[model samples]
Target: FVNRNAFGHFGLSQDDFERGMNGFDMIAPEDRPRAIENSIRVMRGEKLGLNEYLALKRDGSTFPVIMHSTAKYLDGKPVGIRGIVIDITETKKLEAQLRQAHKMEAVGTLAGGIAHDFNNLLQAVQGYAELLLLKGREGDVGYRELQEISRAAKRGGELTRQLLMFSRKMESTLQPVDLNRVVEELRMLLERTIPKMIEIELRLTGNLHAVSADISQIEQVLMNLAVNARDAMPDGGKLTIETRNAIADEEVRRSQPELTPGNYVALAVADTGQGMDKTTLEHVFDPFFTTKEVGKGTGLGLAMVYGIVKNHRGYITCVSKPGEGTRFEIYLPAIAGTQATPPVDARETELRGGSETVLLVDDDDSVRALGAELLQMFGYSVISANDGESALQVYGETRGGIDLVILDLIMPGIGGTQCLERLLEMDPRVRVVVASGYSIGGQIERVAEIGARAFIHKPYDVDEMLMTVRGVLDQE
Candidate 1:
């Protein structure tokens, strides 16, 4: 005789349980033998406390449960076994989420370190290539080859940027953005990229709120999702991109603990194609985790998407069933009382150089050599230092004569931040340009706040570096 609670636990009606259904039948088929053996042992006087197993439900789905049992005795003889089964599905889900979070953290650290080193190497290759191109005419023997080398280095730099994005080490320029506009801009590209057989639909709210985000990163997110959807629908299906305004109230917070109650802009991508299983869904956002066969995919697409959303102070979720298709929803906080702004196009300007004495500091040997050469070739008197301590010494000797200080943030002793503080103390009017292989993030922002004259990202573009130097020197 099953209790009403037990019947409810398995999603069973009282009449169904009364039709000769037993406890063993409620346990999953694969776990039945072991469960039966454990029960027999309990009845035969073995004190097995609590065991975990998968409990089968009325619709053939299964959930994790923990069972505790003791042998029932009457007149010194065992009559039956009494037990309790408690569902632990939610507990198991929480545990899995925690483990995934830890794994992502560890991987992110490793990715950030690798990107830093890679950027330094690429800077050397690209910098020298640009220098060579400047000296040779277009038809000169190896001019085209040098151009190709520079382009290749740029592609390598882009890969590192993606790595930095996934590791959450890259900086973003956040602005008020409308999801509907983003979708519209990419509509033609998406249509051309995705197969002709697949149908595309856009369901945009007439008055969706604006989100504070990086427009380029949002475009990347949308493109990645679209490509993923196309791959899932090899036989052709419908892909829907939807944008809507939403509110994360108390009820919503119960499901997503990471979100605070506020207005949000929701962008959802849904596909009618083959879907993912529970196991695949769990690791979908993990770096280098891929379902595609070797050489078909890089596996960083979803991982980068995950990082971009998180970096923007947003959240994302995925839902899918084996053959029922998939859906991805991204929620970014709404910027109330704001309108989406179009990005301004930067006008092309002629690269110019100035006759100013510049002090260049970098620990990397190749980078230091290349930077000193580049600056001198551009008509600036260059002074070089391998570390922050040496940089301070050089600056002290040159004192007022040095017109600009190009300082590298990461150094062996007296790192960038400390060195910057010391330099400020020495001369409040000192002009310094902070340069690094890393993107403009927290540390860079802090340096700017502390009176950094300008900032430049490494793997230096000759024109950009020259332009930045010229721009800063032109300032009072």
Candidate 2:
């Protein structure tokens, strides 16, 4: 006689059980044998405690459950089995989420380290190549080869930047941004790049709320999703990009525990294409995980997107099913009573040369040589040091002669921050420019607060570096 609660657990009515259905029938086919074995053991007075298995419901769906049973006897002979079933589907989900979080943390650490080291090496290669190019005419022997070397290094630097972004090591300049405007501006570019067969559609909502985000990073996210969608629909399909404002209240929080109660700007990219199955969706955001051919994809696209969203304190969810298409939704916190700022032009005008004395500090020998050579070539008197201690010593001896200090942020001894503070202590009026292979982020902000005159990112562009140096020296 199944109890009312048991009937509910099995998704059945009393009448159905009255027709002779039994608990054993609810055990999934693959686990039926183990269920029978456990039951027999319990009936024989073997205290096996609680046993776990997949329980099947009437609708052909399955859920994890733990069964606790004891033998029911009549006159000292076992007559039946009595048990309680407890559903554990939510528990399983929580476990999976915890595992994924831990895995991502480990991968992020590794990625950040690799990007830092790689950027330093690229700096040496690219800097020397640029310096070589400056010495020869456009069509001179080895000029083209030097250009190729420079271009390749630039490409390598871009990849490292992606890695840094994915690892949340890169700095983002956040400001109020309108998602609608971003999508509209990208529409023509998407049309030009995506296959002609695929139709593009925008469903932007009017008067959408503004979100505080890095415009460039947001653009990267959109481009990555659009590319993924284009790839998903090889036979041609409709790709829709939508933007709207949303409020995440109690109900929304219940479904997505990661989100706090607040207003948000929702941006979604959907494609009517071959979608992902459950297994594929599970690992979709993992770095180096891809469904495309080896030469066709790098698999870092979605991983970078995931990192960008998280870094912006946003949430992203992907929904898909085999042959049913896919949709990626990103929710960024809304900024009330603020207008979106237009993106500014970051192009440099000219390579300015300076005649002032500059002190260069870096731990990498190749990087140090390249920086010193570049500065000297550009008409700047250069004093070089291998680390922070040496930089401080050199600055102390020539504090009156030095016009500017170019300090590397990361080094073996007395890193950039400490060195900057020490320099300030020695002479409050000293001019210092902080440089790093890492992107601008918290460290940059800290140094800026501690009195860094300016910043230059590594795998340095000759023009940017020189302009920064000259600008800092010329500043009153």
Candidate 3:
């Protein structure tokens, strides 16, 4: 007879118990055949060490469990069977989390490697494009062509950024953010960006708790989802953005492997469009998996959303049917007593130049050369180092003359992070502008925490590079 605890584990009450309710009744329908086959082996005096399966509870929910069964023989022949059933729901969740983390890490390593090489190539293309632009007026021959090249290179840079974000390689500056405010702000944009045929609705909860996340990345997630929703409803349909405070109880947490038991803020994007089938939904968050025709999609939207949510320590899930519309719910952990800062306007800032000495450190010779040239053009005397060792040597020799160090993050010999540590040791006041082909996520954030003055992503334009240099140098 199953004990109270065992029955409770299956969400069954003792009053409903009956001998007719065999183990098969508790086993998931899809797994019943396998469970019976294993049990028969146990009955035959075979040692079934351990077996894993999905067991169905009284509420029609399924959970993972590990069972070990052995024959209870009275004589030489086996009479019956006894077993121990251990609940492995939490274990299964942890294992799933670990597997997802490992997968992201492996993919991130590959993305970082490719981005580094691609950024080097773009640097040369963009550098020449800018140089050509300076020689000719906007309407002059090859001037517009140069501008187009620069634009294309910038687009390529964005593609790499999306890839890095999908792999969770991009470093993010996390801060407390109000979910309601994000939705409200996005609604204004959605109203103009989406087609007139598509109706937008905002269902923001009042006094919603704040979540810890990057404001820009969170906006990116919302915009991607909104664009996806618009595309889904070609004929026009209703799109809804909703937010609310949420709490995950133990029972609820078991069903969502990515979520732990805690308070959370839920943001749901729903669309009354042609929803995805199970097959499409399964691969929706996979990079480069798109249902659109060629030239219509790159399929990085959902994948980037997944990576961003994971980096924010949040959980996201999609609900859809073939035609019942679709909804994506993202739950981010919430904290009390925190207020969100309004996002700064994205208008261009006035470019400035400074007369200071700069030590440019980069593993890539092309990037270093281009960076040094650009710095000199901005009125700064520039020195170059191809590696961290040489950069440190230069820093030690011209300690007072070097106003700032623009250090590349991924270099041969000592890595950019290690170099930062050594630099801080040598001069705690060393102002470093950490630069990389990669996004300002993982490694970049680490360096920032260790006292780096600023950050700039690779393939930076003349204006961007100059402004960052001027900004860091001008910092007192």
- Top-TM-score structure, candidate number: 2
What is the C-alpha lDDT profile of model 3 across 126-168, one tens digit per residue? 8868867766786797788889998999888888788878777
Sorted on lDDT, best first, the list reads: 2, 1, 3
Using TM-score as the yardstick, the better of models 1 and 2 is: 2
Error of 2 at 173 (Å): 0.7
Give the residue spans of candidate 2 off by over 4 A.
1-9, 44-50, 70-79, 439-441
Against the hidden reference, what TM-scores do the models get? 0.90, 0.93, 0.83
lDDT of 2 by residue, 35-94 (tens): 999999888899999899999999999999998999999999999998888998877876
lDDT per model vs. reference? 0.89, 0.89, 0.84
User: Model 1, residue 203: what's the lDDT?
Assistant: 97
Which 10-residue window in model 3 sums to the lowest lDDT? 13-22
Poorest stretch of ten by lDDT in candidate 2: 436-445
RMSD, each candidate, Å? 2.7, 2.3, 4.3
Instruction: Please give, for residues 218-306, the per-residue lDDT of candidate 1 as tens digits.
Output: 99999999999999999999999999999999878766767888999999999999999999998899888999999888888999998
Question: Cα lDDT for residue 424, model 3?
Answer: 90
Instruction: State the local distance difference test value for candidate 1.
Output: 0.89
Query: Quick one: RMSD of model 3?
Result: 4.3
